[model samples]
Target chain A: MPPTEDPDAISKTPPEPPAPLAFDRPAFHQQAAPEFACALCGAGLTGQYYQANGAPVCSDCRWKAEHESGPPQAGRVGRFGKAALYGLGAAAAGTLVYFLVLWGTGYEIGLIAILVGWMVGKAVFSGSGGVGGRAYQLLAMGLTYVSICASYAPMVVQGLREAQAAETTAGAGAPEGADAAQGSSSVTRSGSTESFVRMAPNGEPDSQPLTQEEMQAALPLPDDPEQMQPGQTYKVDLASSEEELSPALSLVVFTVVVAVIALAAPFLGGLENIFGLFIIAFGLFEAWKHAARPAILFEGPFSAGAAEATRAPALPEAAEAHGE
Target chain B: MASSADVRSPAPGASHCPACGCESPAARLLCPRCGALLHRRRLEELAAQATQAEAADRWGEAAGLWREALALLPPGSQQHQDVGRRAAEAARKAPASLLDQPPGGAGKMPKILGSLGAVGVALWKLKFVAVFLLTKAKFLLLGLSKGGTLLTMLLSFGVYWAAFGWWFAAGLVISIYIHEMGHVAALRRLGVKASAPMFVPGLGAVIRLREAPADSLEDAEVGLAGPIWGLGAAAACWAVFLATGSGAWGAIAKLGAWINLFNLLPFWQLDGARGFRALDRQQRWLAAAFVVCAFVLSGEGMLLLIAAVGAWNAWRSDATTPNWRILATYLGLIAALSWLAVRVVPMPT
Candidate 1:
C-alpha cells in the first residue's frame, strides 16, 4: 500500500504548527512566597536581582552566563577538506561546460571564465556550511584558476592535432624538395657567416683583400637532393625552423608548451583587450568578496536596573509584600 | 469595583485582584476573581522572545511580541515606555506588503491558454508597455524645463566636445541626460521627491533624492530605471546606424550599450547592486542564469561580470521575498544591452 493512502501514516505526520508568538505559552499564575529566592541560583534575593531570559537570576549567575561563553568555534580542518572537495567538483563541472560551449559555438567566450569563478566560490562556501575565511577564499581563487586553465585543454589539443596533420601532409607530398629546402637554407646561413668573417679582416693592417677565386668559393653551394645522405641526422637548431625533432620528442615538447599556454590563457586573453581585462578582474573580485568572512555586530549588555529605577513607586503594603 | 489602592496592593503573601478586592493564597499567581497576572514572569518571557525575534529579523513577529509585552507592563513605567518604543521600531523595520504583492494584474496571467487567450495576454502586456513608455516620455519632457539641467547639460557637452567631435559629443550628452531623466521619471511615479538631473563634466549625470525609497523593491526600480532608459537610447542609435549607414552613430550606440552594461555590475553604489537587493536566493540564481544565456548568445564579455556578481549575491544569507517583475526587468535589460554592445561597426575617421 502507498504511504499516502494509509490513514495512520497521514495522521502521524502532523501539520506544521504556526510560528509561536512571544507570549504564546499559558500565563504563569503563582505568587512568590514571603521568602524571596533567586530563580537561577536558589539564593535568597535581598538587595537586587537580575532577569535573564525572563527568570530572576542572582548577580553572580547572571555575570557568569553573560561572560562564560567564548567566541564562536573556529572552522575545523574537516570542514575545509569538505570545502576543497566541493570546489574541485564545481571546477570540473565549470570546465566541462566552458569547453562544450567553446567547441559547439566555435567562439571562445571569456565570460564563461567568470562563471567558473562564481561556481567554485559558491561551492566552497556551501561545502564549508557558509564558513568563510582567508583559507577558504584562497582555496576558491586557486580552484577557479584551475577550472579556467582546464577549459582550454580541449581547444589546445585540437589545435595541435590540426598542425601535426598539416605537417605530415607536407612531409609526405615532396620529401626531396623538403630536404633540399632545409639543406639550401642551412648552406646559405653558413655562407653568410663565412663572408662576414672574411670581410672583417680585409681592412686590417696585415690582411689583403680576397681574390676572385676566394670570393667564388665563399658563395653558397647549389642544393642537390642526391647529395643528401640517407638516414643522416641533422643537429636541431633551436632558432631555425628547418630543423626537426623526432616525432615522439616533438610531441612531448609540444604538449609541455601547450600546457603552459593553456595555464596562461586567462591572463593572455585579458591582455588582448582592455575591457576583457577589466571584466576578468571584476569576476575575481566577486569571488573574493563572496568568500570573505561575514561580520556580525552585537549590541551590548543593556542596563535593566535603570528601567527598574523608573518604575512606579510601590505602596507601603506592596513594598512589604515584594520585599523591595 | 476595587479602588486603585486595592489594585496596587494586597495583603502580604496573597495575590491582589485588580477587578475585585478578592485575595488569593500566596501560592496563586493570578487573581482567582479576575485572572490578572500576579507575577512578572509572563511579561519577562514576552520581552525575551521579542528580543529573539528581532535578532532573527522576524520584525513583524518581534513587533507583535513587543506590543504584548507593552500591554502587560504598568502604565507610566519606564519598562512600559521602552517596550512601546521598541514595538514602533520593529513595525518600522517590518517588510511592507506593498513589495510582497506583485503590482498590477500582469502577474496573474493564466498558465494554460488557447491561441486567442495568449494573444489577449500579449496585447494586454503590450498596452502596459506602451503606457509605461508614454509616462516616461511625459517625465522626460517635464525635466527639460529645469534651468539647472539645461546649463549642466551644455557644460558636459562642451567638455566632451574636445574629446569627441561636436556632433558625437552632443549625442553622448543627450544619451546621458536621458539616462538621468529615467531616474527622475521613476521617482515621480513612486511619489518620491527628488532634484532635477545635474550633469558632471566627466562623471556622467545624477539626481538627488529628497526622500529615500519606502522599501528595497522601490529602491531597485529607481536604480534600474536609468539603465533601462540608457538601453533605449542605444537601441535608437543602432536604428539610426542601420538607416543612415553612419559609423559615428554605430559608435555612439555601442558606447551607450557598454556604459549601461558597466552600470549593471553589482557592486558598491552601482545601479545593479541596488537592483539585486530585493531578490532572494532563487531569483538571484535565475538572474545569473539569464546573464549566462545572454553572454552565450551575444558573446559580450560584460555580461560575465554581471553573472559572477549575481552568483555571489545568490550565496548571501540576507534576502527578501522574490519579486518577479524586478527579475524580468533586470534580465530583459541585460539581454537587450548585451546584444546592442556586440553589434560591431567601424568608427568614423
Candidate 2:
C-alpha cells in the first residue's frame, strides 16, 4: 500500500543549512573517543583518531617531556647526515654558477661569486645562528655557502684554465710573421729526454733553458706539455739549472688550496654551527609534526584534555551525545 | 535585565568565564581559548601555524601569510575590519617601485627569466632520470647528491683552503647573526610575537611571527628591525678593518652601507620593500624608482638605465603591498647617508 506523505510533517520540516556542531560538546556519543587524547602529553584530540585538540603538541612536547621518561636521550651524531646533505646541495649550486659565469658572460671574476654565495645564503637562511651575535651566525653561514662554492667552483675553473692553457700550447706553432703576428713566445722540446727545452719570444733558438729536473716536474719529460696554475707566476730562465730554475708559478695549486682553506675555517671556530644545524632540523621537524599536533589555543586547557582522558569507560546512556 | 542575563550567562567565550565549561545552547560557540566567537577553526588557522611568521624572511611566504590571514578574518568584526583595512592599506602601498629602476631593469628581468628557467631544469632532470633508467639501470646513480663535497680526503690544496674558509666563515656568521638580531630587538620592542631566529641549513637565520599585526605599527618596526643590526655589524666590521689597517675594511664598510641601502628598496622581499609598502603609495612609487635607479645606476649605470624600463613594469603592478611609503622615504634618507659613507671608502687595489 502506498503511504500518503504527512503534509504537516513535510511542511514543518526546516530548510536551514545543516548546523556544525558546537565545539563545546563532545564529538562522539558517551564512550570516550578511542585514544582521543595524546598518550604522552595528554593533549586533547581533534579531527579523528589521536591529534591534539587544536593545540600544538608532539615531539616538541616529546623533547620537553624527555626529562621525565628516564635519562635524557642524546641525539646521534647523525653520521654527519644533515651537514653532508646541505653541503652537497651548496656545492652543486656553486659549481653550476661558476660554470655559468664562465660560459655566459665570461665573468671570470672570483669575489662576485663569493658575494653571490653570501647572497644565496642570505636568501636561503636570512642570516640567523651562532653563539655571539646575528652577524657571527651570518658570517658562519656565509662562509659555509662561500666555502661550498669554493669547494666545487675551483674544480671547473681549474679544469677550464688547464684546458685553455693546453689549447695555447697546442697552437703555439706557425712560421715566420704568422707566429710573430702577436708578441707570443713559442716553446720547442728536445728529443727523447726533453732535456734543455727552449722558449723564444718568436721561435729563435737563443731562448730560456729549463733544467732536466724542472722540465720533468713541470713538463712530462717527452710527452705531456707543461701546465700552469692560476695566480701563479713562472719565469723561464735562459741559463737556469735545476737548482736555479723557477717556473711562472712559485707554488703549484695555490688558488685551489686557498679556497679549500677558506671553506674549512668555519668548522674550527666553535661547535655552534652543529647546534645551529640541529635547530634547522628541529624547525623542519616541527613543521612536519604540525600535522599531528593541531594548534590548540590555551584556555586553562585542563577541562578539555583531562575530561576526555579520565572520563572514559563511564556510563551516561541518557546523556550519550552531550559533553563539555 | 542585561546584568542578570550576563551574570547567569557568564560572558560567552570569555577566557575567564566559569560557564565556558558548560554546554552551549546557542548554535554558534565562543572560543574559551581566545575569547573569540568560534565561527570556524579556519579563521584562526593562520595564527595556528608556528612557522608562518617564523619564516617571514621568505618574501613569498611572508606576503602570502599576511594576505591569507587577512582573508581568514570575518569581514565586519572590529579585528576583522582592522585586518581588512591594514591589508587594504598594504595593497594601496607600492611594494618596491620600479620607477627609479634603470630603464630596462636588467636585474629584475634576469631574475624573472631565471625563475622561468627552473621549469626547463625540472624537465631536463625528468628526462635525464627517465633516460638513465631506461638505458642503463645500473648506471643510474640516485642519492649521489647526499655524498660529500669531497670532504674526507683532504687534497694538499683543500687543507689550506679549509683554513681560509674557517676564518671567513666565522667572521661572516658573526656579521650575519648580529644583523638579524637588530630585527629581533625592534620586534620585541614593539611587542610582536616572534620566535628566536631559527638557523637555516647553509643559509642564515629567521625569526618567526605568530600572526600579522592589526596595525602597520608593528610591521614598520619589524621591517625597520633588521637594518639596525646590519648597520651595527657594518660599523663593527669597519671598526675592525680600521684597527687592523686592512684594506678589506673599505670593502666591508661598502657592503654594510650597500646592504642598508638595498634593503631600503620598495620591494616585497627586501627590507626596503617592506618599509616602502608600509607607507602610502605615492611615496612607494617614488622610492621604488629611486632605489632601482640608485642601485642599478650606482652599480652599473648603463645597465641600470636599460633595466629601469623593465623595472617600470614591476613597479606598475598594482598588487597590494604590506608596508607603506613612509618607511621607504625614511629608508631613502638612510640610504643617501650610507651611500655617501660608502662612496668615501677608498677603492681597493
Candidate 3:
C-alpha cells in the first residue's frame, strides 16, 4: 500500500491527477481537510480566512503562501518575454536621461549609471514572474552595458567634433610666408591663465591688446592681482575663455578614465589595477548569482513559505519513490 | 460570540505574533497584544471603523484603526504603504481639542509624555528614517558588496589625492587595501566567510567577516595578518625608494610603515586589541610594556594612551587560550616590524 494511494481501502474513490511537484502537501490533504479551517496549517479560523489555492487559509498561513510560494506556473515564458521587454524599455529610458544630463552638465553622473543597472535588473527580474536564471542575468548585463555606452556616445561625438573644429581654426589662422605647421605657435596657458602669445618677427598684434584693468576684470581674477609689467601688453579674448575650454577638457578626461578602466583592467598587473579588475569580475559573478534571481520584492503571505518548505522536503522522497 | 471565543482560546503553531510582539497567539484571526485582527476580513472592518471614527472627528481612533489595517498587510505591497501613509496623515491631522485633551485617569505629566512620545515616534518614522536608512545602506554597500567597496575606496582615494598628491594617496590606499586583503586571506584559510575590503571615505578600509572566527587565536591571527602584510607593502615601497632615491617614495614608505605600526596599537575596534585578546596575562603585560617603551622612544602621546587602554582590555578579557607557538612568532614579528619601521624609514625634512 503506497502512501499516496490505498487501493484496498477505497475502490470507489474518485481518481485525481497527481499533485504538483513544487507544492504537493495542499493537494494531498485537501480530501481530508476541515472546511472553514486554514488550508495549509489546518488552524481553526476565528474570522474570515484568506483565499489561497482554491481554499480558505488562516492569516499566518496566507502570509506564508503569498511570500514563499512562487507565482502561478502558467504563462511563465510569456512573463519572461514581458520582463525582457520591460528591461529593454528601462535601459533605453535610463540611457536617454544619462546622455541628457551629461550633455547639459558636461559631467558624468556615475550614480545614474548605477541606478540604471539596478532598475534594469529589477524590471527584468520582476517582470519574468520573479524567475531568475543565467539567461536573465546575461540579458540584464547586456542591457545595462548597452545603456551606459549609449550615454557615452554623444560625448564622444561632441569631443571629436570639437577637436576637428579646433584643428580647422588653427589651420585657417596660420600665417603665410612661413611653414604653417611650425610657424603655428600653440599657446599653452599656465595655472595663471596667461597665454604666452607668439608675435611675428615684424611684431604685429592680431588685435588690440586690452589695458591692465580691463585684463584684470575680464578674465575673472582672484583677489589682489599683482601689479602689471608697465610695458607688456595683456590680451583678453571672449571666445577663447577658460569657461569655453572646460567642457572639452572634462569630456576628454572623463572619456579617457572610463576607457582606461574598461580596456586596461585585465592587462594591468600587480597592485596597479588588480583590485579594480577583481571588483568588476566579482560584480559580474554576484550579478549572475544574485541579480539574476527574481526577487520577491512585493510582500506576499507567509503560507507561501510554509508550502514551499514542505514541497522542498518532499522532493527527495518523491524522487526516491519515482526511482523505486 | 466568535470574538469572545477567540479571547478564550489561543491559536496553536503561531506561538508568537510578529506584528504585536505578543507571546500568546490568541485566536487565529486576532493578535492579543494590540487586539488587532490578523485576518484579511479585518481589513475592511478596520477601514470601515476608521472611516466612521474620522466622520466623528475622532482622529486618534481613526489613526489607530488605519495603523492596524496597515500592519495586517504585507509591507511594501501597494495596499500596505498606502494605508501606512493614510494612518500617518490621520495621526498628524488630530484636532487641537484632542491634542490638548488629558487622559481620563493619567495626570498632566503622563499626558505630556504620551503626546511627546507619539510625536517622537512619528517624526522618527518619517523624516529621520529616510536619511538614516541611507546611512545603513552605505554600511550595507561597504559590508556586503565587493564592487561597491572597491569603488568607494577608489572614490575616497581620489578625494585623498586632492588634498595630498596622487603618489602618496595612491600608495596609502593600495597599502591599506593590501592590509585588508591579508585579513581576508587569513579568514579564507580558516574557512570563514568574509567580504572583500571596503573603504569608508575618510576612515580606512575594513574586511567584514560574515562569520566569527573559530576562536580567540584565529581572531588574533587574522588581526596580525593585516599588519604583517602591511609591513611587507611598506618594505616594498622602501625598496623602491632605495632603488630610485625618490623623496616621494621614501615618504610613502615611511607613511605606510607608520600607519601599519599605528594599527598595532591595542584599542577598541583596532586590530591590536584583537591580537592582544588572545595573549595570556603575562604576555599581555609584556606587550603593554613593549608598547609603552616604543611610545617613549617615539614620543607619540596618542600611541601611549591607545596601548594603555588596549592592555587594560586584554588584561580584563577571559578569552580562549591561543596557540603558544603562533603567539610567540606573532610577537617576535610585530616587535621586529615596529622597531624597523621607526628606525629604518627615511623621512625627508
Candidate 4:
C-alpha cells in the first residue's frame, strides 16, 4: 500500500546517522582482546577472569601464581658470606671515620654511632643484592658494634701514654740504687709501673745497685735492646729511662693493652652512662632493622571498577563537566 | 521513521559490529574488524547479571557486568549510554561497600570483646603489638631520602636554630621530620603517590598527595601515621633522657610528645580530623571520653582543646561505620602520648 518496499533497495540505502551518546564511549572497546584463553594456563576463559599484566588469567592460574611463587631461597649461604665481607669492610671504614671525627672534634658524637650502624647495614644489604635476612642482620649489628668500640682505640692509647709519662716524671728523682732494685722486682712481678706504684707505699727495696746484666734480666727486656757506648755509665732508673731503653717495644705493648681496653670500652662506657648505652642500642636496632628482610603484605583482588572510577576523565566533554 | 526493532537488529543473514560498525555474517559470533561480540543475546545476559548484582548490593560485581554489557552495545545507542552511566555509578558505590567490610583479622574477634568496651579493645590489640612495631620500623626505614627532604630539613633547622638554639632546634626539627615522613610512608604503602617531606620553618612540614585516598579508612590511616611516628620519636628521646640524665633530651622528649599530642586535636585538616572520619557516632563518643580521661589524668591543657573538638564531632549526626582497629590505635596513642607528655617534665636546659 506504501508501494511494497523493495528489501534490496532498503538495504542499499545508507543508514541514518546514530544519535549522540549520553556518555563517553567505553575505553575497553578501543583495545582488542588478546585472546579468549587464559594467559597462564591456555585454558578457555568463559567466566570470571582476572588480569595480570593486562592479559586474561584464569582463577586457578592466578591462585597458583600468588600462593606458590616467592623469592628464591637458593644461594642464601653465598649471599650471607658476601654480606659478612661487606659488613666487615664497612666496619673498618666506619671505625676509621669515627676515630678521625673524634680526633678532630675531640667530642664523642653519639649520632656517629647511628651512622656507623646505617653504613654497615647498607653495605651488607648491597653486598647481598638486597637479599636481607636474620644472618645479614646479625652480621651488620656485630660489625657496627665492633666499629663503634674500635673507634675508641686511639683515645685509649693516648690516655695510657699520658699516664705512663706522668708516672715516669713522678719517679724520676728517686735514689737510683733503691728505685732500680724496686722497679726491676716490680717490673718482673707485674710487668707494669701501675702495679709497682700500688705496691710502692708498702714494699721495702734493696739498697744495692744491680749490675747491668742483672738489671736487664729483672726488667722486661725489649726485643732489640740499645747497645751501650764503650765508656758510658748506665743508670738503672726503670721508670724514667724505660722509654729510652725500649721505646718501640713499649709502644707495641701499650697498643696491645689499649686494643683490649678499646674492645671493652663500649660496654664499660655503657655501664657508666646509660644514655650512651641506649644510644648504642638505638644504633644497633637501626642496623638490625635495616638488614632484616622487609615484610611486604599484598592487599587486593579488587574489582577493576575501582580503577575505572579513579581513571582520568580523558573525554573532552567529561573533562569539561568535571572542571578538569 | 525506523521502528526500535529495526534500529536494534540488523538485516536478515547479517549483523553489524557494535564496536567498529563492521557488517558480518550472522553465523559469525564476533565482529570481523574489531572482534567485539556481535551476539545481542550475550549483551542481554550481561545486563541481566548486572541487574541481579545491583539488587544484591554487590556494587563491584554490578559495575563489572555493566562494563561488559557496555562493550557489546553499539556506541551512542541508548542502551550503551545507559549502561556506561550505570557502570560509573556502580563504581562510585563500590568503595562504600568496601568500607562496610571488616578490615584484616579484627573482624574475627568475639563480639563480646567489642561489647566489653575500650579496655577489652586494648587487650585484644595486644597481639598486634609486634605488627604495630614492625610496621612503624618498616615505614621509618622506607621514608629515608636525601636531596629535597635533607635540604628542606636543613632550612627548617636553620630557622629553628635561630630561635631555640641548636640542640633543641635539631631535636624539634627531627621530631617534625619523623612526623612528616610518617605521612609519606603511609601514602607510599597505600600505593598513593606523594611528595617527600618539605619543611616550612615554623609551619611544620608537609607531603602533598597526588591523588585522593579511595576511602575514609585510607584517609584515616594516612592521617594517624604521622602521630604514630611522632610518638615513636618522642619515646626514643624519652628513653635517651632516662639513659643520659640530660635535661636537653628530657626537654626534647616533652616537647616532641606535646607536639604529637597537639596533632591529635580533631579540627580542620589535622590528623585527628582524618582519623575521626572513620568512626561511627558511638565510637566518636568513646574517643571523646578517652580524650577527656587523658586530659584529666595528664593535666595537659592541649588535651582540653582536643577533647572539646572530639566532643563536638561526637555530637554531630554525620558518622561512619565503626573501625575498631583505628579506634584502638587512636586510644592507645592518646594514652601513651598523654603519659609521656605529663611524666617527662622538660628540665631546665
Between prediction 2 and prediction 4, the one with superior TM-score is 2
Candidate 4 ranges beyond 4 A from true positions: A1-324, B1-146, B346-348
On DockQ, the leading prediction is 1
lDDT of 4 at B90: 70
Global lDDT of model 3: 0.56
Q: What is the lDDT of candidate 1?
A: 0.64
Comparing 1 and 2 on TM-score, the stronger one: 1
User: Model 4, A125-163: lDDT tens per residue?
Assistant: 877776676778888998898888787777797888798
| Stretches > 4 Å off in candidate 1 | A1-77, A96-115, A151-256, A269-271, A304-324, B1-181, B188-224, B239-244, B251-349
Model 2 chain B poorest ten-residue lDDT run: B1-10
| lDDT of each residue in B86-188, candidate 4, tens digit only | 6666766665322223337354667878898997788778747755666556655555555777887888777667666789889998899889877876665
Each candidate's root-mean-square deviation in Å?
A: 17.5, 23.6, 28.1, 21.6
**Tens digits of per-residue lDDT for model 1, A56-170:** 4456765554454332356477878998999899889988877666555454656666777788888887777776777888888888777777766777888878987876565
lDDT of 3 by residue, B1-349 (tens): 0100101122234433334333322233433223223454567778778778878988767776776665555342335535655565565566433212232423234354457797855654454446544443443344335776678778868866765668778888877877786676565444456777778644567677765443466568789888887887788788888898777777777777767776776765678877876787767776677667766676544345546665786678665454576557555655655554554445454
Winner by TM-score:
1
- Could you estimate the TM-score for every candidate? 0.41, 0.36, 0.33, 0.35
Instruction: Please tell me which model should have the higher DockQ, number 1 or number 4.
Output: 1
For model 4 chain A, the run of ten residues with the poorest summed lDDT:
A303-312
Error of 3 at B221 (Å): 1.5
- Count backbone clashes in candidate 2: 98
